[model samples]
Target: MLQIITEKFFPPGERYETLHRAILYTNYRVMRGEKIITPIGYLLPSTGLHSLATLTCEMLEKQEKYPDGPKLGVFVATTGDDLLNDFAAVISFFLNVTCTPDPDLTRRLLLAERPSLGIEAVPSRFIRRMFDKDVHARDGEAAALTAFIKQLIGLERETFVGAMRAIRQFVIGSHRLADDLNLAYTLFVTSIESLAQGFDGHVAEWSDYDPRKRKKIDGALKDASDEVAAGVRDAILSNEHVALARRFRDFAMAHVAPSFFRVEAAGAQGPISGPDLPIALQQAYSIRSSYVHLLRDVPRQLTISGFPEATEVDDRKTLSFAGLSRLSRHIIMQFIARGRIVEREAFDYRRELPGIVTVKLSPEYWVASTGGFDHKTAPVRLAAFLEQITAAVLQHQKDAKLTDLGPILTMVEHSVSGLRKPSQRLPMLTLYFLFHQFAGPEFSCKQWPALFEKHKADFDAPTVESFVAHLITGNRVEWTLEQLEELHKTYFKTRHTASVTKIGLLLEAALSLYVAEVNRLAGNNARARALVAFAVDSHPGHAALRTYEASLPAELAEINWTGILLPPRPSSEGPSADPVPAA
Candidate 1:
């Protein structure tokens, strides 16, 4: 019967496959309750095919056994609707034909004749009354046993309600169940969205003669309803109902009400026009807000030193903006865990942390009138202060003095890359500046590269934003783009032709010689003129040769007759002795 029903609805196989996965996922949710805000992945829906196959197969076997008997036309007259109403009926009828003589429970159920004899009746009844304080249960073990036994005793109206209530409470209190609810809700909603995309109001109708197949699907949907109701009940019981209500009110006031204009602007594409979109979005927002304010604890403490007082607006926006962003992240995580949202190993929002990013979470940006401490000045001054503090710390770390300057220079070199010419400090750049400022520019220039290289492997790749975190926490290196570039160069030499290398080496030697000659000039004014002229030269190679040639007096310039390095085998063997210049 079960196989028959399952196959009827799951005809294409894909539906069954998707639904099987979904059922497994929902079972997990029924197990996890309120912590539903946790992440969950996607789930597929069920098809009613297999259930019908089981029913048909059972009837065929039963008819073969009773061929000469009164049961010949009994099952043939039974419709899918009748089979659905009495789920246990098919199993009992089969047992009568196929089993050894008769099974005890099968005989009992077949003879009972009322809904009380329904398969789930007894067990539901027992569980309902067992957990009550007034109920005389000998021990926890006894209570559990009694609950299971009584649950099977048949569902009188009171017992059914009692059983549901107990199950609901149990699910609510179970952390696992809470997690499932959040997961399932997110996954279900996402699946529904996907399903809606293909809906377009087109559906295939089954033949009237195939009514049996319809019954199986309806039965599956009914079972799904039971699961959903159980999950909802558990979810409701897990959290403070009043708090949820308060959250709804707050979300409406802060987001929905204020953002109604945006939705109107969106027109047909908006949530207002969406099917059940408002409720889903609002519920998501409410749950997230509640989790943030009540669980994750956003709107962190703000300590202001030397300020007169913090205004009410400060606290209000704290709860609104920062709080909202945090809640959004939490909700996203919940959906991901539930299989509703796709998970990425890393998330980059770009702007995060006030000290690190110039933009705070507030809607406001630059403030013009706060004297020395407006919004613009605040980040700048804070950066400068951080720089000084880092410099001071490094100064005290006298042990680093013995380290090679190569690594230190590398840090300073890297720090320069982050410099924003206008304000001069990028958020991340400030850290490098602070490192140089505190460790003393010299230490930053010398030790950072070694420190960075030493700890490179320890970096976390899951969320690469922690690069800043690693540096701050390790306190091993001061960083700057200039130093980083130099380090990179040191580690990776460019591979060019040998000719290029030779030219580079020769040019460096020549430039060094020029600097030396200028330093030996007679007067400061003369030295300044020579240096300035060299600096202003448009052609470096030309100016360098010119500078070399003009650096000495005319008498020195004229002595080119062959003696230097034996002047390449002069054919004349010229007796040119100019005190032969040293090689």
Candidate 2:
């Protein structure tokens, strides 16, 4: 149970509080299988004290997120995350009123001294900051926990993991930091920074965002003085948020509604009644710097309601914590509603990798930006290289249970003749789906080579051979590179064309490198190294082979070798009655 560590305990009030020492005894019925004393109890103060702690505790303990929290090292209420979630409710209640709430004594809760527990009473940077912010708030954390929770759960996950951190700061500051009106007011602004930093990634293609030096080096820019340009470029590049305050105010103004500024609390008019959000929000962010770095403090009374005074449009206009909160929360909710991506400007990073090939095609296009490839246009010899890389990933997934696949047992019930027409893409894909499936243990040497040999005109032999090598290594299928042994004996003895010899070498290297990656991920470094060396030595200078060589460590490990790569089907129960297809 939690124990109060403070020397000064507020005197007991009229309502129910926690059991002795203000243990969150009310929130948790039973902790770690041991009974804690009392319920709806608080370590109270005056009239308001008992209601907040009691109501907050009851409401918090019943949330859907409660049971999902960590039960281990949990001392007192729930984990720190859970406790903060409970406290966030208090912030919601505060939103119901619009001012620097009257000074109320909030009691403390500390984990009891258990030498065995590793975590302290507080946890992680986010929670620790939150705990400190929550310590002094007297009121308003009562009703809105559900709304916040709803907003949190509904966010788009790709960016939500990031936005949640900023939201946590806003929640705590909205309630507790209000005690220091400036801290609370600036926090409303700081939360915007959190969103900006989390997702406002650089757009590399936008040359304007690039530093002058980079553009100069890349040959797209020039400056009056080389030294002046050189000295400041790196510094400019390093601070990703170049015009952070301006960007934040700009982005918030565009998204947050003006109506939010005019909102009234208990019939009291809000400060900045006219939508001068750009100036007001900008002033709020400037204050964040001094408060965070200089230990600056501002009077709480000035922010009770930012209105006619904040509306002056002057540099010194102070934003009320109440008004800023409305502005900040509205923008944050709009951000969430817009699917979690921040609206801020960015530098030096991006949300997604640029496409290798801009969609348009050119005759001599750089392969790096692959103008294009099609079955008809792609070089036939490179088929083996593509096959090896694709099979490596497929096999790794099947082995790791990351994917489930069934054993390959039979020939497809299809006519190879139908696959001959270039227009028949579906039939071609069917032939493709059949590629490695025939390489399973039972059909190892039989169906795969037989099918490919008959349909050689539709799909290349080198591609078939590469996948067969994958089957051998992946299943320990008791087969060696019979085709490689054949090619080794014949290639280059009498060079035909340069393309012919190069193709043979690349085919051998793709097989070697694919096996090398499989072995490396399997922890057979010796085998992996041998395979890598063989791959590099075989072609010696093939670009694709070398790229795969360097990527040995980057490949993700996969499992199972499950004997069942595909999830088994009920009708297809085991293998069919005969290992051969009816076709």
Candidate 3:
């Protein structure tokens, strides 16, 4: 029966004749109820049943001469009954299934054929033993083939697979099944748009339009009266088309086709690039809109005479649709490629610290330091540091005796107000602490006049001798008229020169000596001594402070200070300020 069927239905060729004999031999087993097993390689077009049969016949013709050689039974016994049944099923499927090849089936056949002559024929003994096994295996193979086909076509491998499938279907002419170019175009555009949305999610800025609109609405509500805000929100919601148009324009203008509007040349006669993508997309969208809305005019023109007219309007519309499809594919693929590059190049945004922490002394520390008047507007790092420092300071302040901190705090606040840079504030505050340690907590502006007054008699000579004596004595007295006038005009006034006379030397020496002792107690002895040395070497009066240093009380000179060491204040040429006694 197989021989007759092959002779009648199969094409008359060397290929068909060999395949015919293999089918006959396989069929004979089924008739005899003998099991037959088939190798997957026997399904290959070049090396399948035809090749197996040709090899088997060649071996058999020589068996008469050498009877002990390979036997035909070896090949026949393994070409199992299951293979026959599968072959039958395949045939029935081809006959019953639609005339058009199933994309899935075609894909499977291609993969099954891919192994470059590596797959081998089954051995008879093993084939007999696994006849039923091969039956189940065949079913599994079918499923695997379907999977392999999907893989081969590169579908279901990414987020944009559905879009790709639509494109693939159109390219392969499967779109003809529906014979609806309009619907095909719609699906292509829809898929492309879906891909664009996927691209948007992976990118920055492009993904923000909708959220930004919502944010705008949220912000408006904060300023509007309840009823007015509600009305405004309703108005915005009602005008979604306007918002969508604006968003589409922004995206199309920015990324997909930025050069869509550029002139082709540089001159007055240079042609303006026309039929712009944005405009084309607008028209494409209008067509889609017309289709969706079932506009009376759209259906009449689109369906007339079973085809669109060859008019200029129709040609332009068709061209626009084609352009949009091609553009979408280009844009999606470009973004996907861009997204990959971004993924490869992305880096962590965290920054390393500079290893120096500035302590904030008050609740408004960051504001005062940064000059950011409003706390909400402070720099992120500054604000964070402020919080950390404020917490630490408050915690430390809880344990420490904060006596006479009021005057010192006032000085710090006043100095901070005068400072320009945030970095300068911390060092200025450190200077305040050095001054507090030098003059004691009782220090304030009230003591200024008294100290100057005590030097009044010395200033009679208008000489340096009187100033050194006053500092060495540490006198407490109100400022006399002559002393106050001389001190204010000479030392405190703007554009005043450093007092180089004996009085100036004595004041500078005393200030530098006190600064050294304060810094030494704070554990920065080296820096403190360096500062004193620098002061003494730079100015003549500063040397007098070292000379008077030994005359200070032992307790004042030797008190043990235990705390974090503060960095030295930056150098300045003028004399450090005199201590102001607390009011």
Candidate 4:
């Protein structure tokens, strides 16, 4: 029956994929109630004989005499679920149950056919006895094969040998029914893992291996995977065209096609260089290179697609400090790919922190190359970029749902316009991302110290200090203008703090008119009174009016009350002055 199936379904020297698929198809037909029966029925002689036993004996004999003879038994045994089980039973019975110590038969069986059937013949014994005395006779041959493989993996050897070793193991092991293709498949998929292990364990030996071996293994795996895929496609070709083709195309794109370029850039055949980098950025770049190059023990793979233009070719200059920072790895990869680099003068002094500069990658070559000199609406674009940074930062924090940062971004947008234009957006975003780093859930004063430290160079110390003071006071007053005044008044009264430098800072520019008026009437007692009145009108919290009056000389506080444009004081000696001041 096995012979008939093999002759009918499998051709000579057909690949494993074809045989496996044909068997699967035959099994499917049987399950679906096909009336077809195998033609080689006489080998069984009677229904009393175990079909598996007869099939195994015949296949063994044929294979020993003719190793290249056809692999028909696999198709017969695996196709019929019952046949495979019975085959194992019969083979086990002959090996152990019959208890015949015939050395020639065992040797012939072991040496005659391929190991694939022998593997299949083992699992039927309820327990594996392949390592027992009966199977031990073949150990010498197996050990030789294993030793050859061990040498193939050694370092200082040719990579081609390593690849050949793997392929040989796959082919030989696959031929055995009990070979555990799953394990083989796993090791096969990670051919690189084996190479890496060889490279680590025996570097000197691995060095002797062929350099082209890695490529060979990669090619072989890809070919095998492709063949498996083709078989799958053949089995399902009639099912769906568009969908199946699309799936196959996707699979091929993912596994077969190499999307990344793996060019070596070391020693002399390196990437194009650029201006020399500053020492600080150089250290950072070295770290970046190690990460990108897979110098570490753990394997790391990064997709360079996001940075298609990255890849600096050798033969140029190293990047400058500013260039290094301004050109992030993404941009650098592009630079490498393009054989170009950024200029040092392009970095802005105030905003050129390594963190900021490093994040400034942009594919917008126009903006990146011109350094922001050409665009008519560069300011607007700059603003938009800053807003993007703010949005990304806020995105990292969400309970507030502050989707629109237009107002605050608008305030700082001009900071980067014209002479202030930044070459990259990454730094801005990095800064923004960092904003939420130390910020409390409420984005409160917890971040003030660090914020001050970071921005101190860019912002006026007095200005930020006063702003913080105002915020603390403002928050205390629920940010209401009226409450702000009341709070100031209460603070002065309770704390006996006469100075209002902080408040004055908050109101400095807005109070210029009042300051000019006070200086105009300097040393005039009555004018001082008018000045105090003006202060009170502008800031009702300037309830310290009498204190201001006392601070001035008595004459200045009294001044000429009659002719001046000042309104009359609420006098105790006469009727109050008119509500309206003199025109």
Name the top TM-score candidate: 2
Model 3 off-target regions past 4 Å?
1-178, 201-242, 245-275, 295-321, 341-583
For candidate 4, the lDDT comes to 0.28
Could you give candidate 3's per-residue lDDT for residues 462-513 as a string of tens digits?
2222333333344332444355335423432322332222123324434344
The regions of model 4 sitting more than 4 angstroms off are 1-150, 157-176, 179-423, 426-583
Clashes of each: 87, 26, 15, 58
Provide the lDDT at 467 for model 4.
Answer: 28
Least accurate stretch of 10 residues (summed lDDT) in model 1?
A: 21-30
lDDT of 2 by residue, 394-422 (tens): 33323211111112112122433344453
Model 1 CA deviation exceeding 4 Å by range: 1-131, 134-421, 424-583
lDDT (tens digit, per residue) of candidate 4 on 52-166: 1111111210111134544654321233333232322222322221111233433333333333432323321112232122232232432432333233222222332344343
lDDT for 230 (candidate 4): 51
Q: Residue 377 deviation, candidate 1, in Å?
A: 19
Give me the displacement of residue 561 in model 3, in angstroms: 91
TM-score of 4: 0.16
> Candidate 2: misplaced stretches above 4 Å?
1-53, 56-148, 174-182, 200-239, 261-270, 273-275, 296-316, 340-583
When 1 and 4 are scored with lDDT, the better candidate is 4
Candidate 4: Cα lDDT at 355: 25
Work out candidate 2's RMSD over C-alphas.
18.1
On lDDT, the leading prediction is 2
Score candidate 1 by TM-score against the native: 0.16
What TM-score against the true fold does each predicted structure earn? 0.16, 0.35, 0.24, 0.16
lDDT of candidates 1 onward, in order: 0.28, 0.41, 0.33, 0.28
Q: Give the TM-score of candidate 2.
A: 0.35
